[model samples]
Target: MKMLLTVEIPHEPFNSLVRGGKAGEIIGRILEAIKPEAVYFTEQDGMRCGVFLINVENPSDVPAFAEPFFLNFQANCKFRIVMSQEDLQKAGLEELGKKWA
Candidate 1:
């Protein structure tokens, strides 16, 4: 399934990493390990954030996607399933609407 992984990293350790010029290196390592299909870095709620789109086979795979940030940055992570337009089109909504209507 396709999933969006949102990560918010607090200031303490992350600030330290930035000061030491290691922030990019750490982020690079995480990106290398997770291998996200698409990744973005931006700010959210006044914190540093990483947004990643990835595909996985099972919920158990959550740890592999999240643990690096958690242990290294004490980051807050969220996962959500997403569907493309093609997936939505194949959902059989018309058939369900006919029955429910």
Candidate 2:
């Protein structure tokens, strides 16, 4: 099944994890290593955050991926996982249509 993992992280944790020009590098390495189908980042209420959509061979990978980030990011960070199809419906995402862009 495919899963969409949304992570809310503090700006300091993000800054501490990587340096200038290195966020992309870290994300690239993570994608290459973990092989998530898609990854996205955004700012919310002026806070740094991200979402990762991945196709997994088994259900267990969900917690596996989440744990590391939780441990590393720690302070005030939160993680949420949604099965792609179900979440889109619940959030009325389909109704947004092309406006998602």
Candidate 3:
């Protein structure tokens, strides 16, 4: 399934990493491991943040994706299932709506 991974990194440790010049190295390592379909870096809620689109073959794989941020940056991480246009078209929404309506 396609999943969106949002990570909000707290200022303290993140700042420390930046000051120590290790932030890029750490983040690079994590990104290399995941090889996300897409990734964006930005600020959220006044904190450093990263948004990643990735494919997760199984629910059990979530921890592997999350642990790097958790351990390195003490990040707040969230995951959500997402759909492409093709996936949305394939969903049986019409039948479900008719059944419920």
Candidate 4:
């Protein structure tokens, strides 16, 4: 399934990584591992943040995806299932609406 991964890095570790010049290397390694379909980095709530779109084949794979951020940056990570337009269209909403209505 398609998932959106959001990572928020706390100030202390993030600043440390930036000062040590290891931020890019760490992020690069993560990107290489996940191979996300899309990724964007920005600030959120005044902290470093990343948004990634990826495919997760199994629920058990979440730990692998999340652990690096936790161990390296003490990041707060969240994942949400997402669907493309074609996937949404297949949800049978019309039938559900009729049944409920």
Candidate 5:
């Protein structure tokens, strides 16, 4: 199974998580551990944001990984995990990720 992980947030979220800070380092490690097929983010106003997908072997395992993020940020975010097809033609995976990205 292949997974596409999407982390959507306001523009500043990128800075808080990836701009050479301690939090950034922690996030980098988390991303590496997850080994998401891809990573993408988007801008939302007033700090509200959305994360699209985080593919994993067991779809149910998302919360285990997600809880840390929520705790770290003290923010509200939504997550969704969907089983994907091995064949791209049938899965339409590329098109799906771009819809939100």
Candidate 6:
């Protein structure tokens, strides 16, 4: 399934990496491992953040997606299931509404 991975990187470790000029290198390595469909850099609650869209095909694969950040940056990671338009269309919402209502 498609998942959204949100990473909030703390100031100390990331600042050290940036000061040492290794930030991009590590980030590139992590990105290569995850192979996200899309990634964006932004700030969340005053911390540097990364938002990624990726596909996790199995339940056990969740850590594989989030662990790079955890091991590398001690980053806080969150995973949320997401859907494309085609996925929404296949959700059977109308049928469920009839059944539930």
Give the candidate number with the greatest lDDT: 3
Q: Give stretches of model 1 more than 4 Å off.
A: none
Task: Count steric clashes of candidate 4.
Answer: 0
The C-alpha local distance difference test score for the whole of candidate 3 amounts to 0.96
The superposed Cα distance between candidate 1 and the true structure at residue 71, in angstroms, equals 0.6
What tens-digit string does per-residue lDDT give for candidate 5 at 19-94?
A: 6566667667666766665565455565534343555567687776566566555545555545545454677768
Model 6 stretches with alpha carbons more than 4 Å out: none
**Candidate 6 lowest-lDDT run of ten:** 63-72
Per-residue accuracy of model 6 over 3-37 as CA lDDT, tens digit each: 99999999979999999999999999999999999
TM-scores, each model vs. reference: 0.95, 0.56, 0.97, 0.96, 0.50, 0.97
Preferred candidate (TM-score higher): 1 or 6 = 6
Clash count for candidate 3 is 0
Question: Which has the higher TM-score value, candidate number 2 or candidate number 5?
Answer: 2
lDDT of 1 at 33: 88
Clashing residue pairs in candidate 4 (N, C-alpha, C atoms within 3 angstroms): none
Can you list the residue pairs that collide in candidate 6? Answer: none
Q: Order candidates by lDDT, high to low.
A: 3, 6, 4, 1, 2, 5
Q: Write the per-residue lDDT of candidate 1 for residues 1-101, one digit (tens) a residue.
A: 99999999999799998999998998899899889999999999999999999997888999999999998899999999999999999999999999999
Residue-level lDDT tens digits of model 3 in 48-70: 89999999999999999999999
Kindly report which residue stretches of model 2 are placed more than 4 angstroms away from their true locations once superposed.
20-22, 75-101
Question: Model 4: how far is 82 from its true place, Å?
Answer: 0.5
